[model samples]
Target: MSQQENPSSLRLQILTCHLAASSRNMASEKEAALAAVPSDSRTIFDKIINKEIPAKVVFEDDKVLALRDIAPQAPTHILLIPKVRDGLTGISKAEKKHCEILGRLLYTAKLVAKQEGLDDGFRLVINDGPNGCQSVYHLHIHLIGGRQMNWPPG
Candidate 1:
């Protein structure tokens, strides 16, 4: 969510505030994605990561950042993104070198879902490209929860 709406994001706000308040080592997520379509520089995610823009950060570390999605598609929609791109635009662009970080991202998502009090279940999604209806070009793992999700999602 936007920084303006962070206070209202409830769980996310609480988590981030608690983390930030607990540790000064916690680096603020930037504003927007670092990369955009046409392979240009800077996307909305970079702003969010930098805190240049605002987002309800749920979890963060030196390598990754998890935050609430501004345009949530589910009751619990959190986007997990790499703190640094390192040339990973999406799954399609994933190279052999990307395997380690990719695995870390998925594992982290699992860790985050559990940490979010989702003992029942959760869904992980990655919108690939235009065909995937992805408006944002940067790669992000969408962790959706709080309901039953179906196969062949529309």
Candidate 2:
């Protein structure tokens, strides 16, 4: 589906397990309390991670969540996000200590893309700030595939 066709289209299914008591919504679940930028951060990622907003969960782990992008640029466009924000805004905000997370996120992207049946080819993108056309502030890995990509992707 296209963004223009259905603006609020999120293909998420319940992929998380609750370990604490909260309200009816999973958005109020256990991890919700630990969200550092909970209020200050309202990006699509926040919604995807918090279960406040829905998304097609492609792959998930204790520290990560991979889902299909609502606004797909390719036949397969998935966003890989950290379950814990850890103050990462983008690739630029990555510090020396972020090596583990940075690697994990990328590794997860490849795994997700392959799981999507993109054995032919795929691309991993990390859009930075304004110049990088990054609308969302949270760090995310864009896994695009199902076609022959080109160089100098702009």
Clashes of each: 21, 1
Cα lDDT tens digits, model 2, 1-154, are: 7642332321111112232324343343223322322123667687778899877898999888998877676888888988877778777887888888888998898788778899998999886643344556688898999988877563
Writing each residue's lDDT as its tens digit, candidate 1 over 1-154 gives 7653443343343344434333342223211211123253676777788889888999998878999987665688899998777677778878898888898899999999988888899999896643343446667899999888877565
Provide the global lDDT of candidate 1 against the true structure. Answer: 0.70
Candidate 1 regions off by >4 Å? 1-36
Q: Quantify all predictions' global Cα lDDT against the true fold.
A: 0.70, 0.69
> Which candidate achieves the best lDDT against the true structure?
1
| TM values, all candidates | 0.73, 0.71
TM-score of model 2 (CA atoms): 0.71
Clashes of 1: 21
Candidate 2: which pairs clash? 12-55
